[model samples]
Target: MQKHSSAIWTGSLKDGGGSLTSQSGVLSATPYTFATRFEGQNGTNPEELIGAAHAGCYAMFLSALMSGAGVVPDRIEATSTISLDPTTEGSPTVTAAHLDVTVKAPTDEAAIRDFAEKAKAGCPISKLLKAEVSLALKIA
Candidate 1:
């Protein structure tokens, strides 16, 4: 089996910071642009991580579902938004995840919807999250 890699940095509790670096021994600074990374104390935070995980997981799940259903999607684009709400203890937790998925395929509406629902449940990241996740799927 092959393993992927990422790096993080930290300091104190409130004054800490981190960055994820690509390091499969490939030695590159890709995915480290200011837009994709670099965060302040109150910027570029955990919700972004959750969104990334959700989008990736959902895309993979949809691909698998399409393949299993004898339909090959020409394109699958999924955007996931994660909302955070504060707990009673004043800590922020993910409250919800919303996925907008657009898929191009030659499948019927019912099959598309069934695959969308299955993908939502079968995504590993979706299973890991405690947040309420919803999806809007558009198939054409």
Candidate 2:
């Protein structure tokens, strides 16, 4: 399935502003600006959206792996921390995606960790990102 989102930007790079809209309308006309992206101003940024996608995909994939392994999980929460740092080319690049995952189930912790590691490496977003990805799994 192909998904899509578009952005409309105006003005120069530093002073320009844009609105991001998703095909699903979940991010209907979300505002973003240079200040919001680099200065931590009030608005959504691409990195935040990427982090959300990574977390959501990883969690869902892990849950599916659990179900496929006959270990239905009670809960699986994945939080992604994306690091955007300047590269040698003077452009901001995604350097890492760290996932702090918490799982609640009666299954073996080793099994959960195994599935979580798989999800961390096999998620579509994870595969798309060339940055370093790390997973920290906690069982509850």
Candidate 3:
């Protein structure tokens, strides 16, 4: 089970642009540029894509953990905030990924929190990232 994505870039780094395409075709030729990535211009960037992957993986892993424990969740909303340190010595570095999650379930808060912490550590994306990962869980 391997997935892949491709990108094509043209021109110099600061003045260049790129388009990304995923194997699933959900992001067919999506546009990204230096301004979009570093200047907070409108459009998508690698950090944003990574955050989406982290959040989605976290939610799905949490659901699986809940199912294993016989606790069904009505909702698991996760937001991954990726922090980039642009002033790093040579190049920008992703420093941290903080997950803000809200879980709606009919289970004990303690159980849900335990499962969430496990999911935070167990998710594949979480394991892939080298940045520090933190979670703030809310019961609803």
Candidate 4:
């Protein structure tokens, strides 16, 4: 399966603005701009979107891994923090992604840790990103 999203930008980098749309229509003409991205304005940005995607992918992958191991999870919460370095040579670079995860499960902590590590390394988003991926997991 394939997924797609589009962005349209107009004007210079500092003065320009753009809108993003996804094929699913979930993000139809969502606004993003220099202020939103670099100035912390009230709008969406690419790093925020990447964080959402990474968190969602990690949660789902962890659940699947636990299920495959015959342990059903009660709950899994994942938060991804994407670090962007604007001082990079040509353009800003995403330096790393840190995942903070909390899991409530019927299994032991050791099993949960094993599955989480596997998911962290094996998730599609994790593999797709070139940045260093690190995880901090808590079993509750």
Candidate 5:
């Protein structure tokens, strides 16, 4: 059960460009550049892709967790905000990820919170990220 993605970058870092391709062609040759990553360009970036993946993965994981806990969620949405910031020594790094999650279920607040926390901990994408991650859960 191993998957892989590849990236090809040409030229220098600041002015270079790259394309990423995943095992599935759904993400083939996705373009990315310095401006797209650091600046607010209307192009794709690794961090943004990571955020999307994290959000989707967390949502699905939460759904399963809720079902396994004898609770079914009517709706589950997770947003992952990945922050890239400069380190103490001025090196750029992925500082943190803040997950904002909302769930609709016929469950107690305590159970919802517990399930949300467990989902955040058990999500594969969350496990892959080494940065600090925080979860905010809302039940309705």
Candidate 6:
């Protein structure tokens, strides 16, 4: 299970712009610049990509957990917000990740909470990230 993405940058660090391409071509030539990363400009940034992956991973993992317990969910909505802050060494660090999840399931409150806890701890992305991970689950 290996995925790859390539990036090409030109010019100086602050003034340089780059394109990102993934093996699946989803991000073919997707533009990123210093402004996008540091100044909240209009373009994709690394943090945003990480958030996307985390959100997607959490949603899928939750669905699987629910299904395995014979409690298939009707819907699962998840959002992952990665907290990026500067470290003492003047480098960006992922300090934390907040996952907001809403699930529409036909199950008891106890079961839903149990499944949510399991998924939050068992998600592969959660294990990969060293930062603190917090999950908020809403049942509907």
* Residue range 1-140, candidate 1, lDDT tens digits: 54445645556544554565444544332233232333333445457767987999999899998998799988889999987664436666667899999888898888888899999988988887954757687785
Q: Which stretches of candidate 3 lie over 4 Å from their true place?
A: 131-140
Could you tell me how far off, in angstroms, the CA of residue 73 lies in candidate 1 after the best superposition?
0.6
Compared with the true structure, model 1 gives a TM-score of 0.68
RMSD of each: 10.4, 9.5, 9.4, 9.5, 9.4, 9.5
**In candidate 4, what are the lDDT values of residues 58-100, reduced to their tens digit?**
9999999999989999999999999999899999998999999
What local distance difference test score does each model get? Answer: 0.73, 0.89, 0.95, 0.95, 0.90, 0.89
Tens-digit lDDT track of model 6 for 1-140: 88989898999989889999999999999999999988888999988998898889989999999999898999999999988885546778878889999899999888888888888898888887865757687785
lDDT of 1: 0.73
lDDT string for model 2 (1-140, tens) is 98989898999988989999999999898889999998889889999999999999998998888899898889988899999995548778788899999999878888888988888889989998965757687785
What local lDDT score does residue 42 receive in model 5, on the 0 to 100 scale? 89
Highest-lDDT candidate: 3
**Over the stretch 15-134, how does candidate 3's per-residue lDDT look in tens digits?**
999999999999999999999999999999999999999999999999999999899899999999999998999999999999999999999999999999999999999998955757
Error of 3 at 68 (Å): 0.7
Of candidate 1, the 10-residue stretch with the lowest lDDT total is 29-38
In candidate 5, the residue pairs with backbone N, CA or C atoms under 3 Å apart (3 or more residues apart, or in different chains) clash, namely none
TM-score of 2: 0.89
Using lDDT as the measure, what is the rank order of every candidate, best first? 3, 4, 5, 2, 6, 1
The estimated TM-scores of all candidates read: 0.68, 0.89, 0.91, 0.91, 0.87, 0.88
Instruction: Decide which is better by lDDT, 1 or 5.
Output: 5
